[model samples]
Target chain A: MGVPFTPRANIIMTICLGTIACVVTSGCLLWFAWPYSDYERHVGWTVEQPVPFSHQHHVAGLGLDCRFCHSSVERSAQASLPPTFTCMTCHSQIWTNAAVLAAVRDSLLRNTPMTWQRVTNVPDYVYFNHSIHVVKGVGCESCHGNIAAMPLTYKAKTLTMQFCVNCHRDPGPNLRPAENIFDTDWHRGPDTPGPAALMALYHLGRRNLTECSICHR
Target chain B: MRCAWPLHVLPGALLLLAAGCDDMSKQHKENPYASPRSAPADVAQGSVEYHDTFHPAPGLTPALLQRGRSEYQAFCAPCHARTGQGDGMVVQRGFPAPLPLATAPTRSATPEQLYAIITSGQGVMYGFAQRIMPDDRWAIVAYLYALRRSQQATLADMTPAQRAIQP
Candidate 1:
């Protein structure tokens, strides 16, 4: 048979193959990196809630403790949101006539809970317990970031497996004194214990924090 | 013909692979506080109903006082200041000032009465029955008494050892 193709066909085929290879390689890289990206992880994203609750006003301005609203953080796996009545504890007296508190009043009157959108969350399979972390001297700001500074709450950290595993592997640097556990603005000071001392103080040295079952189960 | 058959099978294989890509992050299980329904009222421990008669206060110990101090700060410090002065941040922000713990009426009030006040709303103050445990209520009562004593403490009231140690 006579040559069915020109010599230019080889050059065309090489270009076509090179383009396909480049596309496939980039596609694979993007597929793997997509979930790890902050955009996909919802980090720093502000979620809309039924009410525009301001952590800045309540926490920094009014000086309300973290436990005031999230009452079960130290006792339960979940850091429970306050019931409507908890809001009424102050709103009933202070902001009684404000139009902004209409939903809170409605929730109390209707006896239906005002559904709050969770700003930070993990997958259902990951059993993250607030009580253990709080008790172990992990300050609220360590994971939640500067909550007192957030006028409107947003997801402060990417709560990915890598984020969890990084802390699980070495929890010492994150640990704070018991007094500073709830302090959102707490930072290590001159007298603050070092990593090894804190690890020993919290008795975390003996525990296998990175064990799969610790979180997965 | 053989290449055409392979292409047909390839499409089916790709479809099967795509079917497995469904997200497993969220499952059909309930997360804590995920439901919009209001939680059922908390029933008092060792009682059938939410309301219960007087229960004796827990024995006072250093640990109990420590627990009481932390609990008091968390729950009561907003309206009742950390010093029990009834001039807390919330009060400054416009909530009516609660009676200072050292006030005669509050001072003379029985532990059971203080516990009741904490468990059930007394005037504008919301009842913390749903929030604070019964044991914690008693601990707070104990702390309140301690707070009252501290507010009224004089040099004469201090022990000889405490007086000596005072700077």
Candidate 2:
């Protein structure tokens, strides 16, 4: 026999090693990025509900306040969903015969609760409180997006650990004045207080908002 | 045998990675409204069990009035206009208009009676006893008094300080 190996074998070996390296590198990148993607986070996805309630019509068209139905937002951890009675408060008279409101009317008549699908949520391990955020002047639009504009309510934010930590690290820029906390369309105006002033106003100084127990426990 | 050690480590590495996978997102703990039957059961009409008479009205303070104003805006302003004209946005959208707060019957009604109407259904309006807390209901009553006074006030009703600021 000649030699056990040919000169061409070195070139073939190099090619195989290069291909493997490329595949492993790309696979690592994709694995790390998968959780952060909006697709994986279910952002902008509308959940199917018993009744397709329109936030746009009730919030924008009718000019109803968010607290009108979510009455416990400023007082409780969960911004409680409205009972069937809340729907009947208006539907009993205005949309009494509409086909879409049949489920609502039936719920009231049967004394069953209308099951509303939760559109936005964090993981069970995360203890997020709506009252604390609202009390601290975090605008509803900050996490919920332009709620008055969504015809069918959808998850507007990623609600991932990175998303929560980003705000927790620097909360001033996300805060609003007490009066503007509920205004979904509010933006920082020339007269609006700067982040530092708002930080002082809300008494956010000296507190470790990013402490592990602050959100995790 | 030395090369086989890498193969042995592979299984251990895989087990380490698998340890990270868990059902933490959907833990066994109960969250708010998690159950289909989370809502409170409806009380029958004219049920004496629904009486809130034990929870007396809180004393009037500026803070109480402020809380009342916000609570009223949230709970009452949908059907009863902010100005107590009974032509709120919900009314404009075809819900039956409530009687104006400045009207004879409402204006002459005592605070306790107003509280009762809010606590229980009055005519077409549904009772808000389940939604509004007792303290907040009292606050709303106080705010309604302020709204009525504001709507019915004459120029003579203004104090010197208020009159001076008037255009």
Enumerate the candidates' DockQ scores in order. 0.47, 0.53
| Model 1: residues with Cα > 4 Å off, grouped in runs | A1-18, B1-19, B38-55, B157-167
lDDT of 2 by residue, A1-217 (tens): 7987787997899999999999999999999999788999889999898888899998898878898888779888988898877777777889789999899888888888777778898889999999999999899899999999999999898988888889999999999988788887889999999999999999996799889999988
Q: What lDDT is reached at residue A158 by model 2?
A: 91
Docking class of 2: medium
Chain B: TM-scores of all predictions: 0.76, 0.79
Native contacts matched by each model: 0.49, 0.51
- Clashing residue pairs in candidate 2, if any? none
lDDT minimum window of 10 residues, candidate 1 chain A? A109-118
Give the alpha carbon lDDT tens digit for every residue of B1-167 in model 2.
26778798999999999999996889988755666666544555567563346878899999988888888887888888888889999999898888898897988999899998988868899888767878998999999988888877899998889988947
Q: Indicate which candidate wins on TM-score.
A: 2
Which regions of candidate 2 fall more than 4 Å away from where they truly are?
A: A1-15, B1-17, B38-53, B159-161
CA lDDT, every prediction?
0.86, 0.86
Which window of ten consecutive residues has the lowest lDDT sum in model 1 chain B?
B40-49
- Model 1, range B1-167, lDDT digits (tens) per residue? 25768887999999999999968889888764566754433333234443555567888998788878988998999989999989999999888998887886888888888888888768888788778877888888888888888887898998899988947
